[model samples]
Structure formats: structure tokens, C-alpha cells
Target: MPMSALRFAAVAALLGVALAPAAAQAHRSWLAPSATVLSGAQPWVTVDGAVSNTLFYADHVPMRLDGVKAVGPDGAPVAIQNGATGKYRSTFDVQLASPGTYKIANVSEGAMASYKQGGETKRWRGAVGQLATALPKDATDVQVTYSSRRVETFVTAGAPNTTALKPEGKGLELEPITHPNDLVASEKARFRLLTDGKPAAGVEVEIVLGGVRYREKGPELKVTTGADGVFEVSWPEAGLWWLEATVQGADASGARKSSGYVATLEVLPD
Candidate 1:
């Protein structure tokens, strides 16, 4: 190969190595709202859910709607309308009955176990309560892991409020100091990470702008929570962005558990 060809190959090899970790996590799950802020007597917002290599592109698979839910500004359960699943994405709509913010999320939790029964290894996945019956009576050397995940977005009918943004205190969640629907480009926004309702410190969060398919590389920002579980970011530009984080610890019963949180935020131009 010519000297120029050799250099190009070397660069490509290095790039691949650097991106290996990212590729492993390339399939990102998110919920995208058509509009974050709205005004009217009755306002409605449509949302799309998908798992894709590029943010909000919906190329991989549709996110299941079984775990999707919504909360009104008064902390009441809001109904999802016109929910449908397609080949690459799931679609749903929420009507803003009251003039405040609404929280829409897809939440899921489950446990996995591996054990030896009759000198054979077996694995089981289901709700934690079913472990007793799912595992054989003679099962030995059992190990169980619990996991929880939440993907969320915010929509405001008139003004944003904190009622719907309250943390459930049971899993990984985002407590926004700056309203999620009020993000502005070049302005600083602060958020806190929580695990089981308490401050989660030293957690790493990955933020990336949407429309990755249109660019050579998507712009990404990485931030870590402080001792108080707070992190700040100044938006580089105006667009839809995705933020994700994960934390691992033991649950109340002393079983290993992992929790993950993902949010899609829309930033407005300043």
C-alpha cells in the first residue's frame, strides 16, 4: 500500500478502537415529543418511542408500550390516547387537561436469576415475586440480579410545574433544577440524579444531540454528578437532546441491583 493509504488505514483502525465502547451502547432508547411547550385551552402532544443507533431516528426497533405511562400536573395518572406500535417506533398522544407540565415515561423492572438444579445450570427472568416458584426446590448456588429502567420526556401545556416531576424514590430518576421544557441554547441547566429517592453522587451522564444520521459524528457531552448529585450543562446549540445514566447498587434486601434513566430534552434557540 502507498504511504497515504497506510496512514488512512491506521487512522481508521484507531477510530474503531476508540469507538468500540460507544458502539456497544449505540442502541439508545428514547421518547421524543412533538412539542415541549404549548399554549391553548386544550393542548395535546404526540410522542415517539424507539431504540435506534442514531438518536430519534427509529431504525432499530420500536419500544414496547406496555410499560408506558403518564402523569398529570396534579400527580394524577393521565391516559395515553391513540397508542400504536409500528415496525420501528411506538406512537402515543397525551392531552393536557390542566395548564401545567405532564410527565410521560416508559418504566420497567425485572429480576434475573441463575442457579444449579440437578447438576444443570438454568437461568430465569421475571418479576422478583415469582422467584420462589420459578426456581426448583433443589436449586443451589443461586444468584439473582434486579434491574429497573426509565425513559422519559416532558411536555407543558402552559407553564411547567414540579408536581409531575417528583421522583418516585424507587429507581434512577432526574430531578431538574431547570425545567426540562424550558431549556435554552447556550444557557446553563442543572439536574440532580437520584437513586431510591436519595441523592446519587458521582454518576456519569452522556448527552447527545439528535440528528446523528445527518452528520459525520454526533456532538456529545459527558458530565458527572457532584457530591450533591447535581450536574450542570450549557447547551451548545438548539435541538433535541438525549441524556442517559446508569447506577448499580444493592437493593433493600441486599440483592445486587442496577438502575438506568434516560430523558429526551428539547432545547430552544436563545
Candidate 2:
């Protein structure tokens, strides 16, 4: 059954799972030695191993495997999709564009829960994989990381080039938004803040718009970020104010940097 998004504590309690309060304080995970690598070049891969049991009732969390440019042999992150009854698989047919050492890794973190009894949540950190070896061997199958644990990667040395056009989707594009001007409370003015080219939420924005050389009562308002990364401030009266947003990331250490864009707007009688 599809799960409804629930609060952290509520989800954990009902799901009979644990939640990592912060990225630093991560939960231990179970990893499986089983994995695959596509030989060649291009994008990077994320290292994954453990059988992460996240979400409401599902035994393992559905994860999309990404690649990293690890130095070792010729390999690229394989394109992946859901296969047969909850199992995810990667398809690599490009045929080792280049033969050299390739690195593999996983860089993702997610959590989900069930909708039964309100909601149950399970939290886990994905297993960190440490696989390294050379590619394009003479044998039909070869092991890269562990000789005792031979993994088979389909790469035929000196194999004939068979190029085929495959349909692929490009990754998403991201941009950053910038603005000028802040709002000062005494002066009446409207204001908004943006981050990463999108509306940022859970941010403490400062308004310092109007008001000039003359001194005025200075008061900073603490505002939480909305999903759209936007908030409206109605001017109590006409004045100037400045605008700025506090930088806060996933961890406490990530909170010190500030990258807020400021725009000035006027609020008049409705």
C-alpha cells in the first residue's frame, strides 16, 4: 500500500524503526556484497551495499543507484529502473567506452513510513561500498574487488564495436536566485527571499528595507520557510527595511553560511 507522509517521531514510533536525528549521527546498516558495474566513462556512481529496510512495511528501501568517477578501472554508472516485484536493476549496454579503472559509490539518503495506525517510519543509512579492480579481462567473467568473491561484468576485450542509439533522459537542471534590498521594520515595505533558484523554506529572514540615516526601532522577525520558499510581510506602517536569510543546511554545522537574495516591494492600503 502507498504510504502517507507523516511526522518524524510519529512515523518512527508506528513503523517500529529508528530515525537519524542528524546526518552525522547516522544509524548502522546491513550491506550485501552483491553488486554490478558497467565498464566505460561518463557520469559517477554512488556506493551502495546494505539491505536498507526503510518505509512502512516494505523490507528494503527502493534506491536508485548512481555512479561516481572512482579511480580504478573502466566503468560508468549504469542506468537503473524498477524490475520484477520490487527489485531494482541497472542496464549497461554502452560497452565500456574506455577501459580504465572506474569508481562506484552511492550518495543518497531517504526515509519513509506506513499509513497504518496513523503512520510508521523506518530510518536507515545506505551501506557504503568499497569495490575496486581492473576491467576488460580475457575470461568470460572476472572478479574485480574480491578474488574469492568473483563478480561477472560483461566486457569482451577487443570486441567489435556495436553502437546503437538508446533513448535516455537528461538529468534535471538547477539554478540559483539572487535579489537585492532588505526591509527595515519601521519603514513599510513588502519583501521575499529565494534560494538555489527556488523558494526556500525553514529560513530565518531579516527585513531591513526603508528608514535612512535617522535611527529607528530595530527588530528582526523570525520566519519559517514555506514550501515555495516564500512568505509575505505586511507593513504595519510606511518605512524602509533590509532583507536577508539565514543559511541553514541539513546539519547544525551547515547553518553558518548565508546565501539569501533580497527583493523590495511596497505594501499599501488594501
Candidate 3:
């Protein structure tokens, strides 16, 4: 299966999975590394991948490794092996040699079905395979809208590199002002969220340290963008962190759609 196909599979599978207590507005894909900063004794690291509505939880389904790619510390291609897909998440291991930052990313893009009725518009919840068959047969205003998605994470061996974590100018991208791999729990970290290579204001960003989920009423895990589309948050502790943002816009077909971006940051202990 291809990257888009695998993502669709995970989305379609969500209809069958039990929903969490708090349902997210959209589904996000993520790549999380086992160790953000490797030591001399540790020669390898592992990554977990999944596409689900719930952040940091494999409640829906695991992501496929059909088109996964990893760049080593020295910007060389790293060979990923022993990839295994499970019911909830996918796991892969990467060997570490050089002493810098390693980046692992996944990209998925395809068309989505949308129903435009009057001023109100709604998008299909699942895969494109469930298009008209899963929707009402009498539906008249169905539009095939295009969408692109990308998710990435970083890990450092000895020192972190800012050049390696540069944004790829995707739909929703995070340009880290502070090094993602070298974040400390006591200090605040800043990031600029960009949409189509430009700063996006008023974007909803969810920052979670550890496994805590984002809630609208909670101030600790959620923050919105300002005029510069920049936000800073202090890490509660040192551990694995997940940051996700969502934005809605019209596709090339003039159909209203939504896209999400997820990035996993590993903060060192204070």
C-alpha cells in the first residue's frame, strides 16, 4: 500500500475503533522517537508511528511504513529495518552513527470527498473508498477535494542542529526557534507555525508533555497563535512531548477542507 492508501486505511478503521472520551476535531499523524538524545552506550533508537484522532494514543489504528523515510545526524539516509505494524501503532528501529540530529518523516497526500450544501459544507469522515457508498445516495453536491499531509520528529545523538529541522513549507509546518531536541524542562521554548510558507495567525495549537490529552477547558495543554503565529510554552517536566496544530482552508477545487500537522519533541531532563 502507498502512503495515501495507508492513511486512508487508518482513517476508515477509525469508524470501527472505540471513540475516546474527548473526541478531537481532526485526525493527525505522528512519528515519535524512543530516545531524543542518544548516549555513548546507546547505538540505536526506535520510532513509533500512528494516525489517529486522539493525540499520543493509538486508539484508532497504527500508521503503515510503506513510504517512511529517515535522515541521519549528518544528513545521510539512514536504513530503517525490522518495521512491524500492529493493531495500534507501527514500530521501526534506526541505527545511530554520527553525532547530530536525526529526522524521521512521513508524507501522505490525496483527494477528499466533500459535500457542499448551501453555505454549509461538510467533509467525509473516513477514506475516499467510502465516498458515495458510505454517504447518502441522493447526495447531489459532492466534490473531490485534494489534501496533503506531513508529520515529522527529531532526535539528536551528541549535539542538535537547527539547519536539519527547517520547515519543508507544507500545509501546516512548525519552524522551531529553539532546538527541538535540546529543549530543557525549565526554560520556555518558542515555535513559529506556518501555513504555505507564511506565518499563520489564530491557529489552534495543542502542546502536551507526556501522555496528557488536550482539553478545551484546560489552559495547560492548549494555546492559540497571535499575529505572528508564534507561541511559547514551558515544559512541565523532561520527557516525550507532542505538539499538533490544525487549520482549515479551501482546496484548489474551491472546496472547504481541513489539514493537521503533528511534531514530537523530546525534552531532556533538568
TM-scores for all candidates: the values are 0.90, 0.25, 0.73
Error of 3 at 55 (Å): 5.8
lDDT of 3 by residue, 54-120 (tens): 6667777799887688877556678887899999899999877777887787765545554544545
Model 2 lDDT-worst window of ten: 143-152
Residue clash pairs of candidate 3: none
Preferred candidate (TM-score higher): 1 or 3 = 1
Candidate 1: residue pairs that collide: none
Give the count of colliding residue pairs in each prediction.
Answer: 0, 56, 0
Mark the regions of model 1 whose C-alpha exceeds 4 Å error after superposition.
Answer: 1-24, 252-254
- Runs of candidate 2 exceeding 4 Å displacement: 1-192, 218-220, 250-258, 264-270
Residues 71-111 of candidate 1: C-alpha lDDT, one tens digit per residue:
99999999999999999999999999999999999998876
Q: Give model 3's TM-score versus the native structure.
A: 0.73
